[model samples]
Every structure is written in structure tokens, then in C-alpha cells.
Target: MPRLPPAPSKHPSVLGVDIGGTGMKGGIVRLGHGPKSGTLRGDRFRLDTPQPALPATMARTLAQIVSELDHREKAPDADSRVGVCFPSIVQRGVCRSANNIDPSWIGVSLQDTFEDALQRPVTVVNDADAAGLAEARYGAGAGVPGLVMVITLGTGIGGAMINDGVLVPNFEVGSLELDGVMAESRASAKAREREGLDWPEYALRLQRFFSHLERIFSPDLFIVGGGISKRPHDYLPLLQLETPIVPAMLQNNAGIVGAALAAHADPADGLLR
Candidate 1:
């Protein structure tokens, strides 16, 4: 393979976009050298995810987001490079599976599509993996040693596994089977809403899920993310397990900041390899 470019320094700003089932959000991120280093330069810009969400349509929308966010006045040092996190299983820039996205996304090259649309250098990663990286380096999991698993309990369960600070990309723990069904089907935030579950009832599902994970990897820490993470006290205390679990500090912004980190850092620099 050809050599990759050297990682950018901590001072420059990079554009980060997070594509999800409901919305696409973007912002310019300024990176620093310590924990919670990624900060948005301006208000986050959001657009509804288009119906059908086809590659061509979404690419156009993505380009629009890039155009709106990559302004010289707001981010003078920002270059024509972008990092994107998508709701899919991305490996080496290719999307292997679609999550809450059109089935046409499977087998597509996420990096190339965005790069072609925006005419910029792009880094693409799985949304959950991006969140996990952010949490591991700059959020709740920061300074923690050994294995850390970041789990986002959103519309679906998304997982990322980090050892020390290096990411073991595409961990996909959400797919694990529990009670004869995919774990997310019963344990995810969407499932809670769909089933009209109270906080304690939801905790029961989460307890089962976490217990299952404990029996397997036995991670050093578990960082819970997603919209639900903002209200962690409601359900987190009810789960009984040997492992320590905490809410993600970055919460909804983790993917955006993590995408920026991926864009500015080289894959070999304690990121994905």
C-alpha cells in the first residue's frame, strides 16, 4: 500500500460530519492535545436525512453540509479534508453493512463517495467506532487502563472496543444474541420506547445485556453513550455487574469529535491501524 500522510498537528481545524438515520450533522472541530480536546468552532449544522437516503441523494446533501460548514471565516485554517462517521459497518473505507440506512449502502465505498461529492480528502468510519474512540481518548473512558467498551444505546445498540487508546474497530457487540434475539432488539433505546418500558424495566434489559458482555470480554470499563446517556442516573445504577459503567461525557457529540480526530490523526497514531 502507498504511504499515508503524516498526522496533522493539534492546532488546525477539521470538518467532521456524522450521518445518521434521522439527521446529518456537521461542524468544524478544533483539536487540542489533552482530554476533551475536540471542540466545535461554531454551532453544529443539521439537516434532515433525506427519504430513501440513496447514495446519490445523500451525497448531494452531504456536499451541501460540507459547503455550509467549511467556511473560511469560521475556520480559517481548515483545509479541504473531512472526516465522516456513518451508521454502518465500515472497513477500510468500504461499508460492509447498513444500519438504519438504505440497504444500497452495503458494499459502497463511504470515503470515495464523500470525497467525490465534496472534492476533498475524506476519512470514513463506523459511527459507533467513532464515538468509542472519542470516549476512549477524551471522554468518560479517558485515563482508564486496559480494555474499554463504549456502547451507544440509541435507535440501536452500537459498540466500540478500545485497548489502552488503540481502537479495535468494528467491534459490533450489539449483534450478540440474547434471549433468542439480537441484543439490540430488546435492549436498545428504541426498543424501550417501542415497548413503553419504564426506567427500571429498561434497566432490566440493560442488566441482562451488560451481564452477557461481562461473561464474554470482561472489559475494564463500560462507557454508555447515546441520547439516553444524558439521563444515566435513571437506569445505570440499577444494573448490577462487576465492571464499572459510566455515562459518556461527550454524549451526542462524540461521533463528530471522533470523526475530526480520525481526519487529523494518522491511522498508525493510536487510532485505527
Candidate 2:
């Protein structure tokens, strides 16, 4: 397996933004020299996602976050770049599919939009992929061997697959069909809430979904993330599976940290290759 290029030392920190359905968040992340070495430089700045979340409106809101975070840093580098994690399947800076955000995002060049808005180079990636990269490098999956699957149980299921510290971007396992329905439709946190399922009920759905994944991919490890990860005891143990499972250590910050890591590495080079 190929190793990821070292993060540039001269620009030890960079801004990472996570664009979500309900909020947009950003922060400066300090890159360290070893595994699990990323840390937030200061408090993260957030703003409500615009109601429509169209490309232009979202870009403006993102610019505000970038401006706020840059101001807070107080020593902005003109050459420093920005990394954004968006809820879509991004390919070569363009969004191929929209999830949670506006349909207008489809086919939009997130890189160009954000760069035009913030006046800096931008690296855009899938939110789940960003979270997985962060976990694989600086959180739960750090130093873990073999294939690791990072699953975010949020409003919808989000997934990332990493092997030997290399990320396989946009895995989209949540879209898999389970029992004739989209897996996330029945297993996601939103589903649990919508159906008023207790932990045990939710675990039953998760068990089916994970078991399907196990039969197909047989990943070595599973890292469950999102706000629900804070309460691993509530659902993790209830589901019986062959693969070892753990909660994400970074919680909500994984996407931000991972986006910074991607920016620091320069995504054009193929992030985490």
C-alpha cells in the first residue's frame, strides 16, 4: 500500500469547514507529526445553513464562516487554503449527488464556488469521507490495521472505507438496499427518531444493516460516529456482529479535522493516497 504524503510543515495549520444540512462549521486545525496528531486551534465558528442552501447562498454562508475563523486566527497566510466537507458525492471538485442539501448542488463545482466566495484555493470532499479520513488518521481508526469502515449514524447513514491508512473516498455504503428498502431509511438515526424506536428497536435495524455489510465487505473494524456516538453504550452492545465496533473519538469534529488534513495534504494529489 502507498503511504500518504506528509502534511506540509510550513503551513502547519489550515481552515476546515463542514457544510451540513442544518449548520455550517469551521475551525483551524493544527497538524502534528504523527498518528492521532490533529487538534483544533481554537473554538469552531458556526452559522445556520441558509434555508434554501443553494450554491450561491451556501457559498455566502461558508464565506462568513471562513471570514470568522480567519479573523479569530489573527495571522492568516495568503497562501493557506481551505478544505470543505459537503454532503454529496464530490468528484474532481464537482458535486455528483446532493444529500440533505439543495438539489441545486448537483453538478455544482463546490471548489470554484467556495474559492470564488472566500478568495482562496479550496478543496471540497464528501462529508462522510472527510469524517472517515479524520478517524483513520487522528481518531478511532488511527494505526488500526486492515480495512476500517467509518459509519456516521446521523440524520442519515454516512460511510467511509479506509484500508492501511488510505482512504477510499465516497464509499456510500448507506445507500445499500436492505430488505428491499434503502438501508438508511430503516437504520439511520432519523429513522429511529421518526419511528420512536428505543435503543433495542434501533439496534435490531442496525443489526440487519451491519450484518448485510459484514456478509458483503467483511470490514475489519467499524467506527460509529455522529452525535449518537457519544452514547455508544446505548446501542453498540445491543447489536451482535462478527466485526469489532467502536465509537468515533472525535465526535462532531471529525469532518473539520479531516477536511484540514485534506487541505494540508493538497487534494489534487489524491488525498491520503
- Tens digit of per-residue lDDT, candidate 2, span 170-257: 7888789988988878899988999999999889999999989889998999999988999999999998999999999999999998
Score each candidate by Cα lDDT: 0.84, 0.85
**lDDT against true structure, model 2:** 0.85
Q: Pick by lDDT: which candidate is best?
A: 2
The clash numbers for all candidates, in the given order, read 0, 0
Q: Write the per-residue lDDT of candidate 1 for residues 36-145, one digit (tens) a residue.
A: 25677878889999999999999999988888886646663434678899998887889898768899989998888988898878898789988987777678887788
TM-scores of the models, in the order given? 0.93, 0.94
Per-residue error for 74 in candidate 1, Å, reads 2.9
Which portions of model 1 miss their true places by more than 4 Å? 1-9, 34-36, 76-79, 267-270
TM-score of 2: 0.94
